[model samples]
Target: MRWISKPLPNNDVVNSLSKSLGIDRVLAQLLALRGINTFDEAKSFFRPNLAELHNPFLMKGMEQAVQRIFTAIENNENIMVYGDYDVDGTTAVALMSTYLLTLYPNVVTYIPDRYAEGYGISYQGIDFADDNEITLIIALDCGIKAIDKVAYAKEKNIDFIICDHHRPGDTVPDAVAVLDPKQVDCHYPYDELSGCGVGFKLIQAIAETLEHPFETLIPYLDLLAVSIAADIVPMDGENRILAYHGLKLINSNPRPGIKAILEQVQKTELTITDVVFIIAPRINAAGRMKQGIHAVELLTEQNISLAKKFASEIDQYNADRKELDKKITDEALQQIRENNEEQNSTSVVFCETWHKGVIGIVASRLIENYYRPTLVFTKSGDKLAASARSVKGFDVYNALEACAEHIEQFGGHKYAAGLTLLPENYHAFKNAFEKVVKETLTEEQKTPEISIDAEVDLSYLTPKFYRILSQFAPFGPANMKPVFKATALRDNGYGKRIGKVEHEDDLPEHLRLNIIYGADDKTYNAIGFGMGHQLDEIQQAETFEAAFTLEENNWNGFTSLQLMLKDVKC
Candidate 1:
């Protein structure tokens, strides 16, 4: 893997801030690398007070969207909350619908089926709303590019207010208000909100118009936090403030759905990483294994018993999802080997009858081996649906747009996207997509790169240092946990034999490891996961270097720091 070091900022400025903040020079340097250099900026970075959140009216078209919603509520018009089928979509629906239900009773929610209706706003949803005498639809997480779909709904006397975060087309949709920050005309200072965040801003605006304090929306931030984490949005600016407060609620008093799910886990305080690994997969399982509506039910359920029931069902769905994901991933890998597709400029694999629900996970898995722009497709009803995942520096959405002639519909961010096409056009689209990637991509873009925050001496590693780092909680895309690289590492003479431990008889020899790292003239014990295979190599080598992150591990009523080795070189 390529190791890319971010350029450090001015050392004098960082040192001054470090002295003022009472933090390490290295930590201050990293903060300055992220453009936080002043005392005020450092305060905002570490504290993340809700007062730092941008005004809801700062977002383009937010006033119009809120005004339209208030008008619908005053008129007693039937309103539908529409969203996508992923965690972001479902969470947005739950947050907006529940908040609206508090103010008006005519609100309902609609999530299109991933298998049948594909992604984004659906004609079936609009038709259903029309039949039910719904006059207004507030779309969350999607509808930025539904130009014709918006026009069609308008023709049916249905007004739409889009609160989305996706990139808009050249011509904006003719909806009542388009609230995408990507719009050229939009002046929202922060542009990296998740779909649910956009929905939250809408509610914030509505609350402001009614002369209500923003704290009135604090309870709803739990859903926003889940969506922000699940959708992998950048945690910075307003997003950082929202996620910081939201996680406080999650730890102090989570909603019934989150509480029920956390009962089976062992974390005392939930961070964004915990939300991504523990909560996101469960919420996503609903869309992958059953329907997106189940996720909304779990998120919005008020009763403990009902929420537990939904959580249990979602746990089962997640199990089923895991098994299917493994099977399809193995099959996709076999196809790559059999056809020698791994050597191609791009990777596109199709299975006629493969489970449509797990292709996205399979596509992500293929990246570990093939490391290319990959697409995994399966037959969905009369069409072919696929999930596209791209390597760094490659915009999968733009590539898909290049091949839009053969695509029926597609939308997503730079790294990940989803698309559908007529079954007859699959071959043509695949070829065209590969051609685009081959023509535009560079050799460096194809290989995986691990970004290292900085190199530091092991002497700098201490519990106090960790305590300072811990303040950078709720880490996600933008404010990722710092990774450090160390060189001239020597393993101690002590090494454990590879064998089954007391409780794990089924584990293979390659799954065990017991090693030590020499730092500051002392040896520290370290346990490595899935690193036993490297035991012989490390033993044979005289010296080595490694990249890792410091993690606090608890065992037998004791807590201490350990190096979580990511990679090693001899």
Candidate 2:
């Protein structure tokens, strides 16, 4: 792995902001790195205000979508709130359906079966809507590429108001309104919304239409924040505001569904990372293991007892998902070794009986060992389906587009995507994808690089400095957790390899250290996960440079700062 220090901010801007805010220069420099040049921008960054969110009506199809929904409400028409099977889709369905049911009684949610319907707007889902006498369908997190399915719904007199964030095709669906910000014609100021974020915008517009105060919609932000985190969208702009307040709700008074899920964990305050790890997988496990609607049911349940029951059931599904993915990942790694394809630019493996639900997770797991673009395929009916994951700085979607001739259908964004193809075309498509990635990936892009925000000395990591840095919460893609590099660091002789000793020959999984920077009488506690192999290097070197993020560690009711080391260089 390569350690790349980010470009330093302009000295003028950093000094000016530091003086104006009366903050540490390091904190000001961190804000400057995130493009906060002035006091106002810094305030907005630190304290995200919901009022600053863009007007929903600014979206290209917002007016039409709101009007269509209002028409459905006025006529008491049955409205089907439809979405994909993942966390973003289910949370979007739960948010939209529950909100619509507040205004009208004839609303229902539809999450297509993962195995039968595959993904996105499906014919089976449309048929279900038609059978239920639903006249209007509000599709969320999907439908940008559903030209045919939308037309099929139209034939049944069902109007579509799509709220999606995926990239649109050459031609969008003929829905009443397509509210994807990715459309070139749509000029929404911030376009990096999660699917649930788009769903929130729709309801924001609806709430405004009814002249309701903005606080009426605050309760729904928890769902939006979950979607934003689970879908891995940028944690800046609209997402930051939504996640900030949503996290507050999660920690203070979450909905029964979320509360029940939280009951299983021991956290007092949940961060965005906690939401991703604790809540998302449970909600997603319902879809991956059973039916997507189970997640929606859990999210929408009002009864605490029933919600706990649902949470328990979903927890089992998550457990099953974990076991299956680990087994399949082991099988996939073995396949790579058996085929002697370890040196390939890409890792593409397939099995006829591999569970379709776990392929995506397996693909990601493969990347941890191989460190390359990966695709894990499984037989989906007559065709083969795959989940694709890419390394840092690589666009899997564009790479799939280059191999479109072999793909029957594909969708998703830069880092992750899903695709299907005929079984016969798998090898050919795999070769083509390998070629595309090999040709496009620069040498630096192939290796995972840790981007360090700034270089700092041990003295700069004071309690006050950390307090200011903690304000940069809810970190994700665009606004990541800050990583700082400290040079001339020596381990205080107590450093050692740590973690479980599984077997006689098994390698230790982590590194523990009391990092000493200077003769300041303070030895900083540090832990480097998966860096056990570096124990010898650290012990031999008199001093080295370390890249790490500062975090608070709590043990036995005592809390102190800890360095989460990323890498070390001598």
Candidate 3:
């Protein structure tokens, strides 16, 4: 792992921000480095107001979508809310379908099955709408790339309104409204909204048309926040405001479904990270391990008792998913070794028996060991389906496009993608993908690198400083928890590996540290997870550099500031 320090802001500007904001110089410098140089910018960054959100009508297709929905309501025609199967899709489906039902009772919800029906706007889903006499489909988080499927729905006299955030192909679907901001001509204020965010914007526009105030939609943001966190969209611009308010709702007055999901868990307040770990996975489990209908059922259920029942089922699904994921991941790792492919620039492993739902996750796990682009494949029906994941600064989507000749179907963003192909094409596609990434990927891109925000002394790790830093809540892309570097750190000679202590050998898998550095007499304790390989080097060195984030560790009911090591250089 490489530690890369970002360029620091100029001293004069940092000092100016420090004086104006009445904050510590280091805090001001951090803000300046993140482009919050002005006091007003800082104010907006800290206090994200709903009033600052972009007008829903400003999106290119929002007006058309609202008009179509109003027409459907006026005609009393059935409207089906369609979405993908994952968290963003399920949550967006719940948000849009439930919100529509409040104004009109003819609305229904549809989710394409991950197994029976692959992804996006499925023909089976359209057939369901036609059988039910549904005239319009409001497709969320998908349909941007379903040009042919949209045409098929059009032939059935069903109009489509696509609310998606994926990158558009050369031609978009023939829908009444395409709300993807990634479209070349469409200009929404922020292009980085999650699918749920786009769905919220559609409802916000509908609310305006119905003469309802904006605050009427506040209850829906919890879904939006969970989608934003799980989908891993950039948390800046309008997204920040939505997540900020959504978190407030989650903590204070979450809906019965959300409240029921959290009934067994104990947490005073939940952050975005917590939502990703605790909430998103369970909601996603419904689709991954079973049919996605359970997820929409859970999110849309109104009664607490019924919601708890749905949550219980979803929880069990998550447990099943975890087990399947672990089993598949271990098998994939073993496959890499059996094939003698560990030295390759990419990890391409396949097993006919591996579960399709967990292949995406296994791809991510492979990156931890191989530290490069990875693809995990499994048998899907008669063909082969694979999930592709990339290291930082690499575009797996582009690489897939380069190997398009052997691909049956592929769609996704820069870092992650999904594709399928014939069993015969698997080896050729794998070779092509590896060749493309190897020739195009930079040396630094292949190596895992941590971006360090600043270099500070151990003395600066004070309660007051940490208090200010903690205000950097709800961290995500563009705004992340700051990491600082401290040089010339000599161990107090009592550091030892901690985890799996029963081994009692050189490789204990974790290390506990006691260090004093920079003329500071205070010895701070640090834990380096998975850093047991560096124990011999650290023991030989008199002084070394440690890159870390400041975290408060609670041990035996006592809380103390500790160094969360990112990396160490001797």
RMSD of each: 2.7, 1.4, 2.0
Q: 1-570, model 1: which lDDT tens digit per residue?
A: 788878888989889988998888888987887788799988888888887778889898987898888899889999999999889999999999999998999988898987778778999999999999999999999998899999999999999999999878789889999999889899999899999999998998888888888778999988888988988888888888888889899999888998999996766688788999999999999988899999999999999999999999999999999999999998888998898776787889999888888888899988877888999999877888898999999999999999999999887778898898998999899899989999999989987888888887776788999888888877888888888887767776665445555475454333223344454456644555656667767777877766677778778999877777767778
TM-score of each: 0.93, 0.97, 0.95
lDDT per residue for candidate 3 within 374-427, as digits (tens), equals: 999989989999999999999999999999999999887788899999999999
In model 3, how large is the Cα lDDT of residue 517?
A: 70
Q: How many residue pairs clash per model?
A: 0, 0, 0
Candidates 1 and 2 compared by lDDT, better number: 2
Candidate 2 CA-lDDT value: 0.93
User: Distance (Å) between predicted and true CA of 25, model 1?
Assistant: 1.6
RMSD in Å for candidate 1, one decimal?
A: 2.7
Better of 2 and 3 by TM-score: 2
Looking at model 2, residue 282 earns an lDDT score of 95
Clashes of 2: 0
- Model 1 lDDT vs. the true structure? 0.86
**Order the candidates by lDDT, highest first — what do you get?**
2, 3, 1
RMSD (CA, angstroms), candidate 3 = 2.0
| 391 Cα displacement, candidate 3 (Å) | 1.3
Rate residue 546 of model 2 by lDDT.
93
lDDT of each: 0.86, 0.93, 0.90
